[model samples]
Target: MSGQTMYEKIWRSHEIVDLGDGFSLLHVDRHMLHDGSGPVLARLKERGRSVSQPDLCFATLDHVVSTAPGRPVTSDNRRRTIASLRDGVAEAGIRFFDIGRTGQGIVHVIGPELGISLPGTVVVCADSHTCTHGGMGAMGFGIGSTEAEHVLATQTIVQAKLRTMRVTFVGNAGDGVTAKDLILAAVGQLGSAGGNGYAVEYAGRAIQTLEVEARLTLCNLSIELGAKVGMVAPDEKTFDYLAGRQFSPKNELWNRALASWRDLPSDHDAIFDAEIEVDISHLKPKITWGTSPAHVMDIDGIVPDPSSTGHRNAVQYMDVVPGRPLVGLKVDWVFIGSCTNSRISDLRIAANIVGGRKVADHVSAWIVPGSENVKRQAESEGLDRIFKESGFEWREPGCSLCLAANGEAVPPGARAVSTSNRNFVGRQGPGARTHLASPAVAAASAIRGVISDFRTMKD
Candidate 1:
């Protein structure tokens, strides 16, 4: 018998019908909508169509809401967007977790936390970071506004299947080297587009050891590697994370669901279209030095020379000498949140680093939780107090300062060491020099007022 991969198994099981020429009418088990999905819902409304399966839809406010404490809807446009989302969800009879509510937060973060994204299922969101749900072993990916409307009209989407790629990480990462650093290293080695057009599965000892939150962090950046779908096989850890959650199955249903999920991993001899192996035995904490995620280096290493086509421009734009080490480079700001890193575990890591320390008087720092749940969880454990005491702004949950979409931005010409993904020009603000790092690094740098190695800080 031929061995089937996890991706193939999920695809075959969820495929309603084959449409030929590599297209299939795929069943979407969970349809997640956010502010960006507002326009699509409006379009569906204009067409006099109602959501075919509103029970499968879940909506939240994330992309454009202010993450400031008290969960303020700062602008009239944002308020209007919120109103449209509420109306659309009400008309469709779908669940809406608005700001300041129990389930509200980044759509990606809250989905898995609430068990809406489960193993052996298909998850779709309008945002590019929708793949973040793949950490729960679901076949999750992003779609466009048009696709959003299609899903809303009918609980299925027409899509071409992607080729499969298996990336294995062998050897243990050193202390302070996290999922963030490992993915950054993979991006550095494979280049940004290496996983293009493939459904990439991360495996091996290192991946197997990551907690569910860390696994989510790794899968969250899969799109940064140019793949829309990135997944990890669900195991005991996945089941543990989902057990007893608000939306998770209860009692007998839980056991039945677990039985089904246990069978979803790929067979031993499953074949993949492409395979890549990476060794993290000697890996160090990494940070992005240029505009692209691929333009990265070790936190303690020297910047790369601008010999590549885009490296010259990236270096010039970043205002850094190529051969200088990233350590000790003065920074003006630090941001430690986003869909990528803002979970309770991420908060603890940063809090541990800055517990009794204060942020550098020269640097401005902020810590925005990924969701309201995360904020409450952190506050319960006094993590917010640690951050605020350390001179970091302990803000409410939203995608704050990550994209500057809510008017929360890094100063122009200021350099920021951030825990968020992406270091693209003006991603945080016009002319902002953004350097991507892990939460620990961001916290330590905020204290030191420079790009720094968090592991070297004295306890």
Candidate 2:
């Protein structure tokens, strides 16, 4: 038998048939929808069609909804979109997690945290970070709005089979190095499009050591490297994280699921189309110097000289001088919450960093949970109190700050250290500057009023 990466193994197992021209028809097991995409399905209903597999599709409101406490959704456009979602879900008999409902959060975050994303499942959503579910050893990706309509009509999607790339991270990370930093370093080394036309399998001791939430953060950015999907092999960590979640199987069924998941890893000598290795021991807390995710350096390192590279446009967009250190750069805001780092663990880490500390008077900070459950979990542990006492606004759960929707945005020319997935210029707001980092780093920067390191601060 030929060797295969974990991605290839899972893909082959789910392949319905080859459709020629490099494309194949694959079966989809889980479908997720957000309020923004829900209206499309409602439009399809006007044409006299219903969801093909209601049981497999789920909907939740995240985008275009204010996460501020006691803020009723007041925008007419937003209300119409949400109303369409409610009507569509009811008409199709699909599950819907309405605003204020239990288990509601960002589409990517709520899926995994609820255990609806399982090993070997084929998941898809209208949002790009659908790849986040791949951390559970599943095959998942995002689709366009029209394609989402097709999936709602039939529980399958047409797609071209992708090449497989294997990324192995060796050695343990040093103090203050996080999965975010490791991925940033990988992006720097490989360039932004290195994984183009491939599904990436992340393996090695360092990756296995990460908690499930951290692994999700790594997989969440796979698309940034131009990969269709990114995944890690299922193991104890994956199972442990799902053991007690609401949608997970219980008792005997749990044992069966675990046994099935145990066999999901790729066999020894599985061949990959391409391979790259990274040394995690050399990783450090990272910060983005340019407008793209690839333009990154260690927190202690200086911004790259634009004259040294052909990508002058990026340097110009970021408005940074070459050889200037990112540390001590004045920032106007700090944002902590996104599908990438809104898990309860992420909140705890940020809270610990700013527990008794106050944000610098000049910097505004926002803390949005990925989901309502995560919000409640943080509040139960008093993590919310820590953030509030430190002058950080702890808001409701949603994709707040990660995207500029719902009126939550950083003003133009404002520099922000965010825990969101991308650092693309204007991604958070028009002409806004975004520097991506981990939750701890965002918290530390909030306290110091600049790009600061969390390791220097003790709880």
Candidate 3:
């Protein structure tokens, strides 16, 4: 057999039919649902069809659900949306994880935490961050609600294969430099549309050394690069991370699964349509100075001159002057949660930075976990105490303030540093100037009341 890249291997494995025009009828091994699934399930019900393979489907309540502890969902419409999801998934016999229930969390975070996303598997979700599961070496991507309905009805999705690219992070990452920084730097170099039409696989020294949670952060931003799918090849680390998770194979089956997963890496001779390399030996923690992620600037660096129309608009909207440093700029809020960086590992990173330090009195900070399990785990480790004692609000699990669609938002015209993936205008709230950084940087900024790099802090 010829050399095969992991994408080629996973793609061919799930292909049910070779459709012309570069598309294929792909059998989906896992389909994850969230409150956004309500409309799709309704469409399926309208067709008088139950899910084809409910056993492979999972649902969770995350988006649209309030993250306020012990407080009921404030919006009647949101409550109704949750109820509809529960009713539909129950009727279809798909596993459902409601608020306050086991496995209830952000769809992307819960999948791997529950072991439903495994190496070499094909995973899809109605949510775009489904590419986050690519950190586990799965062939994962997102679909629209209509496509979601089709997957529910037939357990398959018709997809066009993509050209592939390899983005290698060369050299070592210094202290306080994170996957978030690495990706931000990459986007800064490649621009928002760099990976258009390609499935990008991250590799090399830095990627290989990163923990799985960090890898998830790296892949979570793949969509920002205009790629539908981003992947990392499975290795011993991936296998170990999934070894005993709730839905992982057991006993002899575990061995069999690992053996297969071991073979999922791209061969040395495998060819990619494009290649890009980034060196991070001297890379610093990065933050977005403008709306697009590609507008990243070093945490200690000055705002760049408006070089394009978009840059001019970003500078105007953010109300930041060109050629001025962002460090020590006042910020009104700090958020540390999202599919991109809300895992327990991320929380620990923030906690270590926030311990024995108080959030700047001028800044409001929130620490939201990605899942119920992640919250529980953080509490068990006393990470919650570190955050709360440091004046950060310990929020329940949900995608709060990330998209600001659930009544949680930064105030208009306020400057905020967030750990969420995007910094689009009004992403946090109308006129909110969002600077995207990592959990460590967000935590450090929370204490300093400015966009400060974590590495420069004194003990």
Per-model lDDT? 0.91, 0.87, 0.91
Better of 2 and 3 by lDDT: 3
Q: Which stretches of candidate 2 lie over 4 Å from their true place?
A: 307-311
How does candidate 3 fare on TM-score? 0.98
Candidate 3: segments with Cα more than 4 A from true spot: none
> Could you tell me how far off, in angstroms, the CA of residue 235 lies in candidate 1 after the best superposition?
0.4
Per-residue C-alpha lDDT of model 3 across residues 1-459, encoded as one tens digit per residue: 668889999999999999999999999999999998987898899989878999999999888888888847778888788888988998899999888897999999999999999999999999888889999999889899999999999999999899999999999987779999999888888889998888989999889989998899999999888887999987888888998999999999999998898889999999999999999999988998999999998888999999889889999999888989998889899999999999999999999999999999999999989999999999999999999999999998999899986788999999999999899989998889999999988998999998887888995
lDDT: worst 10-residue window of model 2: 307-316
By TM-score, the better pick of 1 and 2 is: 1
Off by over 4 Å in 1: none
lDDT of 1 by residue, 304-334 (tens): 8887879999998899888899899999999
